[model samples]
Target: MTCSTLWCALASLACLLAAHNAFAALSVDATPPYIKPCRKSDPELNQCIKHSFEHLRPYLIKGIPEIKLQSIEPLRIPKMVMDNGHGAVRVRAQFSNITVIGATNYTILDVKGNVTTYKIELALSIPRIETTGSYEVNGNVLLFPVRSRGDFWAFFSNITGSGKIYGKEVIKNGVRFMKTEKLLVDFKLTKSKFKIKDHLNGHNVIGEAMNQFLNQNSNEIIEEMKPGATAAIGKHFKNFLNGAFLQIPIPVWLKD
Candidate 1:
């Protein structure tokens, strides 16, 4: 894909990881070391649940087999398609084999939740996220038309994000589960760098110029890709969370 497609990786990474922060289950004393259980009755419930993320952070990197959390480190996304037809930057990119690094390395700046209402707001900081992948993309970027198939790498740093998740209770076999209805994500990055191996028939001069253009306009380019990125991640993470939440009953980690 063109270098402009690279920043699409940063679009929802923080939001994806933030989904894990909502994963507290049951009571602390009976749960596995990797799973942090936040009591619904705790007076400082929000803070307790916020710290639960840190307690589970180390486990999320390698994944906890018992809990069925797959490795998040170098997380693999089978595919991602982003489209933006209206903007200073307009492009549609399809990304695959998208290996992402550094999603687990985050600090929870703040967390607010109303367990009864099943709504959560999370604020977080990620030092960086590195991505490598292959893709097919075609579209006009600003004044340039781009079409290509190639390997791409991108690095984003000083990332900060905020998001909210909404869910509703479901009853199953006398147990309770929270089914994610929607997750809204938004983020900003202080710096980003992008690279693509082949483009414009491998003409080094033309490719270098394209890279320069993409990096120079990274912010606006990323903005163009955000809507699609948000919807894509939101849809994927909903299923992912549903899988995890179903496996761990709500009564185990949360109570009414």
Candidate 2:
């Protein structure tokens, strides 16, 4: 072959190779990764989900602005008067500092297409639940503002729910996507307690009066607050889960 013709042929071959390399870089495999179902019975998967929740630590305790509890119905007190010229003091309450101690029952419901559904139970340990806002002095009771802070223990037992997440495999044309559809959550608050203190403004009697009122009507209080509490908690949970896993792709999250 002539030297000029051979040189031209070599140059054409080099250009063809460069074009193939560029196309390879721009193209992605149409086939998605095989995602094995992480069933509840599967101990390894369960453990993995639980451990993965550590990534959610910063977001979890970031303090919700507010979680309003339902109002307590008017009570027909038995005209019981208090000592030292005090009377019945009706109190309305709210809660804060809802911290979770541990989480369990991490179960993956299904893994299909670009959506993954799962449920996790969190054992929330609220160190200081400030349950005080408004006070109604039914009678002439010289109480110190009726503001009380107590240590509350409650269990969000097996909060069964599922989340819809957009997997990374579906990201096309450099468009990032992360969405969380409505999480159908149903939960029960079990083993709840409010350790009432009997010390307010150096007046043990006034504190005792408030504590007695709460103790006597604990059942009614729990029933009234259950619905609102559950709803607020569910909202926070969904937000945290979505925020935690949105940036991290589903496939990468599961594998990691």
- Candidate number with greatest lDDT: 1
Q: List the residue pairs that clash in candidate 1.
A: 25-253, 26-252, 26-253
Could you tell me every candidate's TM-score relative to the true structure? 0.84, 0.40
Local accuracy of candidate 1 as per-residue lDDT tens digits, 1-256:
3222222332232222232334443332344566456777888988987787777677767665654457677677787777667766677778888888876777888889898888988788888888888876688876878876677888888877776778888876666777778877677788889887665455666567767877888887777777766666566666766655655666656644
Looking at candidate 1, the ten consecutive residues that score lowest on lDDT are 2-11
Q: For each candidate in turn, give its C-alpha RMSD to the true structure in angstroms.
A: 4.5, 22.4
Any runs in candidate 2 off by more than 4 Å, and if so which?
1-94, 98-178, 198-206, 254-256
lDDT of each: 0.66, 0.30
**Per-residue lDDT over 28-137 for candidate 2, one digit per residue giving the tens place of the 0 to 100 score:** 22222211223334446545443334333322234212211111111011111111221233333333333333321133333222223333322222111112112222
